[model samples]
Target: MSHSIAIIGASGYTGAELIRLLATHPSFEIKALAANSKAGQSLGAVFPHLRHLDLPDLVTWEEIDFDAIDLCFCALPHKTSQEVISKLPKTVKIVDLSADFRLRDPEDYRKWYGNAHGATEMQEEAVYGLTEFYREAIAEARLVAGTGCNAATGQYILRPLIERDLIDLDEIILDLQCGVSGAGRSLKENLLHAELSEGTNAYAVGGTHRHLGEFDQEFSALAGRPVEIQFTPHLGPFNRGILATAYVRGEAEAVLEALQQAYAEEPFVVVLPMGETPSTHHVRGSNFVHIGVVADRRPGRVIVVAALDNLCKGSSGQALQNANLMLGVDETAGLMLAPCFP
Candidate 1:
């Protein structure tokens, strides 16, 4: 029952994470590790923490034998993912952890990413990888697109409300605080320790963030109309997790009821008791989502908050979840590890 797997971007944060999770996986074997820049380097050299896993050394994607891999997790950056995945063997199932195939329309992809999609044919069949709602499709999909960590956090709180008509569509506002790791393993002057510690600043203001394409596509489709939400994302000082606070117009009881009902059977999503709020600390390093609902002081207003590890549940862990379904493994396989907490 072992599924041979390969990671195309093995030197990045998400790639390291996939190796960490798959290290203890019951049915998945890491067959190849690809990182073009780090080619010929051992996984231990690029990632000291993973030195104990005995995984394959990093290599160029072009050198991989796709015939030997059952599923390939493409952890490359946006534009690069589409190009690499489009050229991958059609026999291998793929779980893409980039933003490449998330948007179904090439026009939407171009509008947000400022480039034409190189794999429109693949996009047409790529299933959205929000495992809670898209599980069935993912189980049957050959290519699955992992959602943005921020987008996943927001949708976890808002999707049920929108679907059940529990919230006012026009009044929905999402304010998120994301840890630095969500930016990936890339280096930037703004992310320097001295520059980011003990401070917080919002970026991508005025609906300019790329993840808005996800919200626009998902929310609008759920509501059967063009539903636009006011979303603002802030870069936090820490290294993991995402906390999203959603402001909406709705009856607290009804909204809470809808969320509780929506996630009642979901394994990874947890709906907390009313009046309790979640913290990014609780769900860090795990494929778990904690959601809390609180009634606002103003009548007809309620606040919904969700917390998850941007690296785990929000990305790599999410990619692994979909890969399991696509391979006919248990949905929660290799994903039951408890959250790391202080």
Candidate 2:
């Protein structure tokens, strides 16, 4: 039985990415696409790169018949997703690709987003959609919230070590570099070709990045106490991908063993051989995360690196992976496409 799916914000980068991957998905069918601004236009018109696939024309959210849809991917902007999702049918399983529902505490949401959560009841039920960490919960959830791309990258490298108690809790530092597409498909002066084309710079410095809320929530839970890490994100000139380098004090062999043991059974996470670090190019355009660990010259220090396509494994791919679990389909069914190579 094929599930009928709807994409609520179908004109954006992540929305297009979802369509690209789901075009070949075996268990789900794209039944509707909603884009308020681009309504009545064909998906090909909005995203020329996706012209190769057959998909529905863009429609306004009000035009979609939620009664006929089994699952919905809410790809709307922050603060907007909660408002949109609040009005959807209770029976519709939703995977939100926004910052709205990722934080569990409403206060935290307001702290990071600067406003109260419009839908607190639903927020309480939303399972954080870090597929590897929250698989069982996601499988049983009616609403799943996708992680921040930067948050996902950092967690993939540190979560396992933190869980195994193999690293210094207070000494973890995450330095991440992400492609511009992670900013979304909106217009901005800084994102223009003239400003972002020839150079790269870091933003949200000094432990101020929003994704830190996620790091605090998840890492704290794993350690059974409050855990904070120094996190900084850099904007790279590239189009897509995220490379996170984590510095910590731990035995290199133990860190390697912890990561390998944690992701050994995971379909989407690949723990590369010891002493071999991953590159963003290696996992480009695929629903895969490549992680590598190596020893630092200084004893009791190690560097853990993780690479993933910010749009794919970090967002849409992760969403689909959770959707598969929620919908009772094979987790790896439509995600077998190999990463693109240069």
Model 1, range 118-195, lDDT digits (tens) per residue? 889999999999999998899999999999999999999999999988888999899999999988888899999999
Best by TM-score: 1
Instruction: Output the worst ten-in-a-row residue range by lDDT, candidate 2.
Output: 47-56
Best by lDDT: 1
- Which clashing pairs does model 1 show? none
In TM-score terms, candidate 1 sits at 0.99
Per residue, candidate 2 scores C-alpha lDDT tens digits across 1-342 of 899999999999999989988998998999999999999999889999888878889999999999999999999999989999999999999999999999999999999889999999999999999998888999999999999999999999999999999999999999999999999999999999889988999999997899999999999999999999999899999999999999999999999999889999998899999899999999999999999999999999999999999999999999999899999999886888999997
TM-score for all models, in order of appearance: 0.99, 0.99
Candidate 2 at 32: error in angstroms?
0.3
Candidate 2, clashing residue pairs? none
Model 2 CA deviation exceeding 4 Å by range: none
User: Distance from true position, residue 92, model 1, in Å?
Assistant: 0.2
